[model samples]
Target: QQQVKQSPQSLIVQKGGISIINCAYENTAFDYFPWYQQFPGKGPALLIAIRPDVSEKKEGRFTISFNKSAKQFSLHIMDSQPGDSATYFCAASKRTDYKLSFGAGTTVTVRA
Candidate 1:
């Protein structure tokens, strides 16, 4: 039940379009949800995160919508740009857990 499942292994979007990725978890014990973005040769960087208490959270062009009852969460990129093209991963972890349960990454490409 510590698994985070993500959808759409790949996505292609036009510049200025919206990019969306979805994830679901089966573990109710998870309390922290975070999204990570990784470039070609760099480590994954934390993009945005949300707690189970928050229904939604937004930062710049990135937004996270969480559903506690459904055990699902999603990420939305508004006005997607070429620079936004990257591999994104959704992860869940509990405060007591030392590691995070990660979803299969979604590779997004934003074409101009």
Candidate 2:
């Protein structure tokens, strides 16, 4: 069963603009939040992640903004490029369970 919900099934963004994807979950037991990026015919790769203890985490041009109380989180891609075009997935998992529940992916297309 899917425990995480994501919005904007697809997105088109101009180069150098910001691309954002949001996700929400109902499970309070979730402690690990991860975002994965995948290209055509390729498996998803872990892009970034956050824990309930932190409100936000950033690496390079990617950022994950988390809301613990609201059970929501978001991914922000700054200066989006054509190479960034891919399907992104938001997932949640509990530390003890070690099983992830993923949201429907959002395909992002960056326009040059």
Candidate 3:
């Protein structure tokens, strides 16, 4: 298992709303989990992440829920705003490898 897959390649959320997306993975060897947020053309920026050791991790408007046994994870956006609109990606890798295997990518739209 060496791949992570995400769905709803695009999403739409209203301001003050919540956006939820899901992802699945095949590799159980991954040791680190990271999420990236990207703008129109900029490189993905590290958002929030969670390791298998933890069930959930939250930071500001973002949260990551991890299900180690299922090899699944998810991202939740609270108080979604227009400014939150962007592309989100989920990735995983081992501590030895910095190269992140990312999902297909999800585009979120938060209307004002």
Candidate 4:
């Protein structure tokens, strides 16, 4: 079984709109949750991350909402611009584990 699940394989948003992506995981051992964004040519880069201690986190236009009991998380982009369009992935890792399990990626497009 896949440890993590993601929804809406693809999304399209207008300029200055909000874009959202969701993720769910089955592993209770997971202690770290991170989101990654990737452009066409470059490698995926860490966008934002959250520990179960906090329910939510926000940085600039990016936000990560996490639910520990529910084993779920979500990413939201505010005022999404064309440059924000990219593939986003949600991942989970345990404190002692070196490997990270990633949910299927979501491809977002911001229309100019």
Candidate 5:
């Protein structure tokens, strides 16, 4: 069962454009929010994350925007490139709990 809901099952973006993925959760107990990026024949890797305390967190071209009151969060990929193509998953979990509930995932294709 997935506690998180994500939109746009897939998307195509041109190189140097921005790709945005949105996710929402109903569980208020969730304190840890992370976005995972997975490539073919590879496991998902943690891209970026943000907690309830912060409205946003940015690292390089990847950014995580969080809204505590709405229980929603988003991932913004800047300067999309062919190498950035992958399946992205939004996940949420409590700090004390090791288990995570993930969204269906969005496949992003960056066109050169």
Candidate 6:
């Protein structure tokens, strides 16, 4: 399945709050995991990524918690802010081919 269903589909968060998004997939053949962040009319940027080999991965203010057995993953935004407002997408691919299977999209709005 090339589709990645992400929910709430959209989100609203206050400044300094935590924002969470979840995703699931059916392709066990996929191994690479990458979470992308996008602003209006812009290409998605890689926020964080992990492999099924690892249970979790984190960056500065971004975190990706993955569960291989469940074929699911989630993104956690710590101390969210207005600047963090954007769309997020969780993707899976085989290797470093640069080809990505994307979620519909998730829009996050952070208010002050």
Per-candidate TM equals 0.97, 0.98, 0.95, 0.97, 0.98, 0.93
Candidate 1 pairs with clashing backbones: none
Model 5 error, position 88 (Å): 0.4
Candidate 5, superposed: residue stretches over 4 Å from native: none
Task: Go through the candidates in order and give the C-alpha RMSD of each one to the true structure.
Answer: 1.1, 0.7, 1.4, 0.7, 0.7, 1.4
Candidate 2: the clashing residue pairs are none
List model 6 lDDT by residue over 1-112, tens digit each.
4566788789999999999999998888889989989999898898888999989888989999998888999999999989999999998888956678988888999999
lDDT of 5 at 51: 86
TM-score of 4: 0.97
lDDT of 4 at 16: 99
lDDT at 15, model 4? 99
Between candidates 2 and 3, the one scoring higher on lDDT is: 2
Tens-place lDDT digits, model 1, residues 1-112: 4399998899999999999999999989999999999999999999999999889999999999999999999999999999999999999999888999999999999999
Model 3's C-alpha root-mean-square deviation from the true structure amounts to 1.4
- Residue 22 error, candidate 5, Å: 0.2
lDDT of 2 at 69: 85
lDDT values of the candidates?
0.96, 0.96, 0.91, 0.94, 0.95, 0.90
lDDT of 1 at 75: 99
| Candidate 5 local distance difference test against the native | 0.95
Least accurate 10 contiguous residues by lDDT in model 2: 94-103
Candidate 4 per-residue C-alpha lDDT over 1-112 given as tens digits, one digit per residue, 9 for 90 to 100: 7799998899999999999999999989899999999999999999999999999999999999998888899999999999999999999999789998998999999999
Q: Model 1 compared with the native: what TM-score?
A: 0.97
Model 3 lDDT per residue over 11-100, tens place = 998899999988899888897889999999799999998889999999998999999999999999999989899999999998789688
